[model samples]
Target: MSDPTVGQLADVVERTGRLIAGITPEQWSDPTPCSEWDVRALVAHVVGGNALFAAALSGQTVTPGDYADSADRLLAAFRAPGALEKVVTVPFGEVPAPIALHLRLADLMVHGWDLAQATGQRADYPDDVVEQALAFSRSALPLVRKQDGPFAPSEPVDLDASALDRLAAFLGRKVG
Candidate 1:
């Protein structure tokens, strides 16, 4: 349970990057499951997020960049020895290393699913990763707490739904 976040984050980044890189020029303007954000915008956000997380881990700040560069920076930062356990400053506030990892992991996983669905690709992320992220989301989302916040209430889905679908539903996304 004490494993570093670098490996898992790398997995998410690779999966997400595969989808982002596959997008055709025309597909860039297409609508995503995120509704508000188009393909290019969504890609930008994910990449930008990687940059931010990288900077936070290093106790530094960064200007967001495109997909390739941001991912490069993120991986470089996370690969440093003791990077995951190092305390750093985040935009919202400073947090322990583990907490920061969880926050980014949740975003990356959900956005990975979003990118896959929008681009007509499968979003079967690693089972263990999905399970861990889903478990975190169940408690961390405002839906379960009945609080008003950015997250919408968890929507109903079939009991036999895939874990990805279930997790998306919990985040107010409907998967077909």
Candidate 2:
């Protein structure tokens, strides 16, 4: 499948970030379908994921801590006014632009649901973005299954009876 446009990915991240930022402190500490992670921790996780994705695009090897650090910096930047674009344009390589964009898009789309669950807010991401993210996850499902680490699941499964629900289920969240 073709990668989403950069504007689309940026919109996904921006819109979801706004939703997440609007959440209360209580929600930040609430549990997510990720099991071990709460909303705040999940935020950190997504930030780390972005950092790793950016680094990968830049042809650099990155550790989880690097992603966490990147995430921390991003959150701080977001808390400031008029910093969205700068924060989103974190340094990334150009060689594999499509993959990097997909990574960013999928991260925002899935985490948006996580944040919604924790905050008791209902959100719907763009259908095109959700569809692309689902396709991306499905493509990587097999490789993800071979790892001997803790993860919800990669194979597609039944879910909440909607596109968004299916997308969430594919990402290991039990949303109905």
Q: Pick the candidate with the highest TM-score.
A: 1
Q: Which stretches of model 1 miss by more than 4 angstroms?
A: 1-4, 143-148
- The number of clashing residue pairs in each candidate reads 0, 1
lDDT of each: 0.76, 0.63
| lDDT (C-alpha) at residue 12 in model 1 | 80
- For model 1, give the RMSD to the true fold: 2.5
Candidate 1, residue 9: lDDT? 82
Alpha-carbon shift of residue 15 in model 1 (angstroms): 0.8
| Per-residue accuracy of model 2 over 15-45 as CA lDDT, tens digit each | 7767667778667778887788988898877
Across 1-176, the per-residue lDDT of candidate 1 in tens digits comes to 33336788888878878888777778888898787899889888888788898888765678687887888788888787787678877654676777677767778778888888888877657877776777877755543344554566678888888877888887888866
RMSD of each: 2.5, 7.0
Model 2 quality (TM-score):
0.71
Measured with C-alpha atoms, the lDDT of residue 21 in candidate 2 is 70
Best-performing candidate as measured by lDDT: 1
